[model samples]
Target: MTKLLFIEASPRKENSYSSQVANEFLESYKAANPEDEIERLPLFETELAPLGMEGANQKMENIMKLMTTGSGIEPEGEWAGVMKEIERLKSADKVLLSAPMWNYSIPYRLKHWIDLVVQVGASVMVNEKFEYIGQITDRPLQMILASGSPYENRFPLESDGTKTDFERAYLDHIFRFLGFTDIRLIRVMPTGMPGPQLDEIVANAKKEAKEAAKAF
Candidate 1:
């Protein structure tokens, strides 16, 4: 049975283009694979605590305790709560993140969620050389990134030679660190632009999402 872990990072409901494209992607994916189980985790709905220094220490202590006790069961704390979300990802065959760009980066909630997910000795490991190695493997990650600037077409760079793909670059690095190399990214850009550009961009993104879902 194919399982999909869909992370909804946009809080703007039906009005969010990223959410709409994600819905389209899931709809098409479900139509193509009727038996697939799709799990949607809305970032706004799930209360995710920021992993400050104190929380990080607590998490490390909890992890070591669990390790020594050999329980491997989640404990009652902020870390364990985040671990539960990670467990969901671990159980899935595919992971999809529908996130809108905010200030040339991912949403704060998405960033925070990622911090919780990328824990040492959990999602990654270190060798004697101090090089990090990813623990999660095989699962393909699909990224539906929505930005107001239409980039990643035949011409992604701006006229001023500025790069607009910061979010994807950062996310790709993170996913690759977690041993996910089979990543798919589809963009919905120039949403805030005037005229028919927004509609045109949305339609193209929807089409891309629909097609990508077939193999997703």
Candidate 2:
């Protein structure tokens, strides 16, 4: 049985296009594979404490312990919480993340979670020649995104030297950093645009998401 982890970052819940589409994907995925275990983690409802001095110190200690003693030893103190999150990431056979664009980027809560889970010796490591390597399992990573404005509609960026897709670029890099080679993105673009444009986008997005569910 596959372990599917769905991480939702939108605070809008049912009102969010990304959330709605992701729900559709999960529903179809469940129907197709009855034995697969599906888990939902909503970032807005999660209790994330600030990573202050104590947490950072514990995190450093944990990383050092892993470097010196390896994986058998359990992490202690606040670092244990960080390790628990990483364990969840490692346990999943597939990962789906739903994120709505906030100021052309991801939500703060999701960023906080990323900061906690993406550790030095845990998620990645640097070799003697200074090459970095990600330690997580190589698996399929799927992302559902909702954007208020279409990529082309964002003027300055479209005309700029490089068309920078903040939402996709940031997430794609991060997931790649964690060793996920096969990553896919389903975008519901121009979501908050007026008239039938948004409806059309949403409809197309839903269709794509449904197809992706079966393939996922």
Candidate 3:
């Protein structure tokens, strides 16, 4: 059976627009692929240890050892936790990320998770020419993003003309760097400004999510 890893980065739970839409997508996906194994990873509940100085040093030491001795040392403590997350990502056939934009970017816990998993000699490699190569490939990644403002087609700049809306851009670039070939996005907008049309907007987003699930 196909293994689908669902990473939830929203802490708002039932009150979160992204989570609501993601739930709809999951329901549809289950109907389309009933035999598929779905694993839910909620960032708020997951015990993701920070890679402090010790963990960082261990990773560098392991990389050096692998390059010279063709074998790396076993990970321990927080480093082992990082390796577990990396292995989980590598084993997944497909991935789904549900997140709400926080200060024009991803949540802190989500970023923490990324830092833990995107490791050299684990999820990526550097060639002799000093070029970076991604190890994980041929997998599809879908992101369900929700934003307080209409950040989707807003020219990717702030009022002062600085770069903005790192939510989609960052995730797309980083995941592609990690070798996700097929990346898809489903967006919900103006979640902070609820109006009379909010219901319709949410309904439409849910409909779009369900349609995407059919082909996912």
Best of the candidates, TM-score: 3
Q: What TM-score, computed on C-alpha atoms, does each candidate reach?
A: 0.86, 0.89, 0.94
lDDT of 3 by residue, 40-76 (tens): 9999998887799989998998889879987776879
> Which ten contiguous residues of candidate 1 have the minimum total lDDT?
153-162
Quote the lDDT for 76 in model 1: 55
Task: List per-prediction Cα lDDT, in the order shown.
Answer: 0.82, 0.83, 0.89
Instruction: Assess the local accuracy of residue 32 in candidate 2 as a C-alpha lDDT between 0 and 100.
Output: 82
Clash tally, candidates in order = 3, 0, 0
lDDT of 2 by residue, 100-158 (tens): 98877789999999998787777787777877788776789889988876774222455
How well does candidate 3 score on lDDT at residue 39? 95
Q: Write the residue-wise lDDT of candidate 1 on 1-216 in tens digits.
A: 889999999999799999999999999999999999999899988877657776688767755765576444354566666677667778989999999988777898898888888876677766669788898899899998888875553323456265455687788888888889899888887788756878888888999999999988
- Candidate 2, clashing residue pairs? none
**Runs off by more than 4 Å, candidate 2:** 65-74, 152-164
| 91: Cα error in model 2, Å | 0.6
